[model samples]
Target chain A: MSTAVLAAPFQAVFDANSQEFSLAGVIRPRSVDEIAYSITEFRRAIDEARGVLYINVKRLAQMNNTAFHAFSRVVLDACRTRSDIRFVVVTSSVVGWTERMFHHLGKIEPQITVEVYDSKFYPGQSFVEDTSFIPILRAQTKMTWRHERTILPRHGMRPGIAMADICCGIGDFAVLAQKEFQPARIVALDHSKPSLAYARKVAAEFGVTGIEYTYGDASEMLLEDNQFDFVTCRHSLQVFNQPELLLKELYRIVKPGGRVYITNEKNSHCLGEPRAQSIQWTYNELARLLSHFEMDVELGPKSRRYLADAGFDDILVESFMITNLDGDPQDFADVIAGWEKMFAAMAARHGEAPKFIDRFRQGFRDHIFAALHPKGYAGWPIWAASGRKPL
Target chain B: MNAAQRQPAEAKFEPLLQFEMEMGTFLSDWHHCDQLSNFMARMISHNRTDPVRHSNFFSSALNELLEVSFRGGSPEGRIGCSVFRQGPKERVRLSFPCSPTQRRFFGEAVARTHKGDAYARYLDAISTDLAPSREIVLLDLAINFDAEIRLEEDDPPSISIIVDLPLEGIVS
Candidate 1:
């Protein structure tokens, strides 16, 4: 017989059939005694479970340091001793720091699995994370001609064209295009509220008007068919699980005579060579690390084929190399910091390996000392492909 | 003689207690460094309920060293920490590579502080009100460079920070 109890800070339910235990509530336990009770109760429930010990921490909010440490200790201890039962933590997306704490606990006991349900992609509709402070720093740095040329003026952007920038984080390209081309109407679409908020603030700061920022899934954007004269999604397509579906959406949204363009990092040429040295991990190494953790991001080269398959005529794919050996120290710092944030976020999202955590810590130091070496150099590759919709 | 056999006798300190951890040297990468600070506090306290008199002092000192290293402008770097009670004293030592700018800034910060304050103002620039415990007392901070002791150092030479932690009834 399973029991349900009011564990003060937690309302734990015992699922007898599935052999699972779940905790949810405004988890703000007052004293060490309460924290101990919570852990002990959860442990007792876990000992009873036969199969997967699903400890759903999805609804836990306001967990102080003591509560978190206490609860994580139980989970870690259970993972260490119990072979008959598999311990799983169903985490919430509200707090990223909790993910880090669990990441550390999981590292201590690498056997535990932390399942975070934050996938926001389907067919061609999805959201990509661009919350790192590094992109703002990149925007502060001057734009390169090679990257700009690939997306801009190639499809003959005129003032009268209606443009839509899909998955536009901070709308840097959109803002730039708005200034240079003076497009009649530019609608920037992105799914992340925080990113869109930042993009809006930046656009407003630039005093650049006539560009509308709409928030929604890219696959099912609230846009009418054949409405936009030109559509562009940069540094985002690769992040989509179904790049082809987003392309199809792009094809459907663009006018008959209009064009659609999208680009992503080719893992090999994505960031210049210094990126590897800065982090002390080569592209191959990073790819392996990402795969080992199951991050499922689109870093591999896949845009060209998808664009062609989406039925665009006169498709053009181009590769651009940005060599920044002569860039400022601050620029290098910003770039490295950006990559560091991105890597940590990725690792946190896909359960950090207990062994790799130590190496990852050392890698940062190695990257720093290597970056500061007198002969330091940095560069990376970006791939962009554009095609016109059938008239 | 074989390399191992040829080596002279090495004096080793018998550690009463010891712990090891690694951290990034840059502070601009806030989350990385913040987690590192917490790790230091956790390790120093050994997650024990016993009051660690000068836990904040250790955190503040470590934060200062990390911030000083970041001033050198290297986007990449790491610091290795070894905390142990050796011989008659307990100490936490951090070692990492440093750039010319980092060395200069760190030296300046140390120099600018009043002798009595022990660079508290300089350290305070990066952190504030660490709320150190009453049991903790300021001790000597030693800085060492790998090459400066023997020959001309590399452009960005390696450096080390040794902070003595005087704990009553806890020392060897």
Candidate 2:
């Protein structure tokens, strides 16, 4: 059962399925009387819920002491009466005071606990946020930028337009876009604090200004709707379990007639001429390995379908190959070498057979060998897709 | 060198933003507290490490102070708010019209917030059946934010409540 109560600028909802009593919008009522209906609904939710009752205040933007006191009263009463049930107050780090305020309640009542909702939003986040993997991420961006600089213009990227780069890991692309296109505004957002810290350091060291690097979950971004002329999320969807949720946010943030651009890889299609058989075998296993971790490494060709399903129109899709020929062969080899170190560890952690891990390790080594070979051609394919929000 | 001369120079605080309105106009609507804080937070938080998170926290803290001012201040006079920044610390000074009784109330409330057991006292204050005290909000800012709060009563009829919030790296 679900019940909703509106108290002017704020609304409260009790969802039985999630056992969550959620409050959103401004709740700065002068007195407790103003939110009596919400309180009634909240009490009913407490009565209905079993096990853990979640008081979700992630979106309660502005709440006064009166409102807090009222809610705290009900929560304290409930804890005292209902010995069978425990309460978990779900707070958002985005809303800074919520965790602190609720933590006071948790301290007062042992049955009550506080959890920051966005702290564990992405499952694959830990793997990608490893600082050791940062160099490879930079190398990947350096190679991909060569193709994207040309591809972006074809997909409606131009000078003096407002743009957002969602899942902008370490923010290299935002800096590149700032220099090459001079977008009027660029908001580059990522979920990782370490990555954003590194991004800020790099931007400061390079004296690159104007890109607002922010921390955010891509699927549930805090960005305003229809604000960006162009939004780009590159090489990120394949790593997420739910690419569509992220694409939905991208579509919502882009202005009508503005485009949402994305890039993803079909890891199984990674090619090298010198060690074609070994490289192909390892690449195929790499796809399966990523799948075991709930990531879709083969999401590149499916980009068009994802965009179309997300209510986008005038879809455009293209593929590009990043070859050893694109830059110094050493850089290409380094990327593969980095991937080998990262993926081999992941495979081992997943408890893959030692033989299977060895083969997987061999493939990356062969790919690197192909990149460094005097006459060899090594290729990594990426699909670039864009769709316009209907005007 | 004199003892004062031997001390390090105080960090300079850069002016960030300031807003002023007639006390009557501010008190006319309850929503003004929310509107002012949200608007000011958005305006100043664009350059923060996490703009959204910073804005949310700044707005929450500022709204509490605004609410306290709204409820306690006299109806006729000018109300002004000025914000200043020194590194990660942000200073908010709110000046509002106050009678002697209101000033005493605010003064005592702010003084109580400086106590070591203020957090425990705050929990007790809110948990009781008695009417909530204005000090609850101040204690919240003092304990939760580790804010430095002080009162300025040099000017008659109008008093300034200054709070310094070390906000950066604290939100996350």
* DockQ of predictions, in order shown: 0.01, 0.39
Candidate 1, B40-153: lDDT as tens digits: 643554322111222322333444434434443344455555565543344555555667665554455434332555434323321222322111112112211000111112
Error of 1 at A331 (Å): 1.9
Q: What are the clashing pairs of model 2?
A: none
Candidate 2: fraction of native contacts reproduced = 0.52
The 0-to-1 C-alpha lDDT of every candidate, in the order given, reads 0.53, 0.87
Cα deviation of A227, candidate 2, in Å: 3.8
- Local accuracy of candidate 2 as per-residue lDDT tens digits, A1-391: 0011122357799999999999976788888888899999999999999999999887676677888899899989888999999999988776667778889898788999999988776766779878888999999999999999999999989999999999898999999989999999899988888999999999999998778888777876656567789999998999998998899889878999999999999999999989899999999999988898889999999999999999999999999999999989999999999999988988988899999999899999999999889999999999999999999
Q: Among all windows of ten consecutive residues in candidate 2 chain A, which has the lowest summed lDDT?
A: A1-10
lDDT of 2 at A75: 88
What's the fnat for candidate 1, on a 0 to 1 scale?
0.00
Model 2 reaches an interface RMSD of 5.4
For model 1, how does the per-residue alpha-carbon lDDT over A332-355 read when each residue is reduced to its tens digit?
Answer: 545655655566655655577756
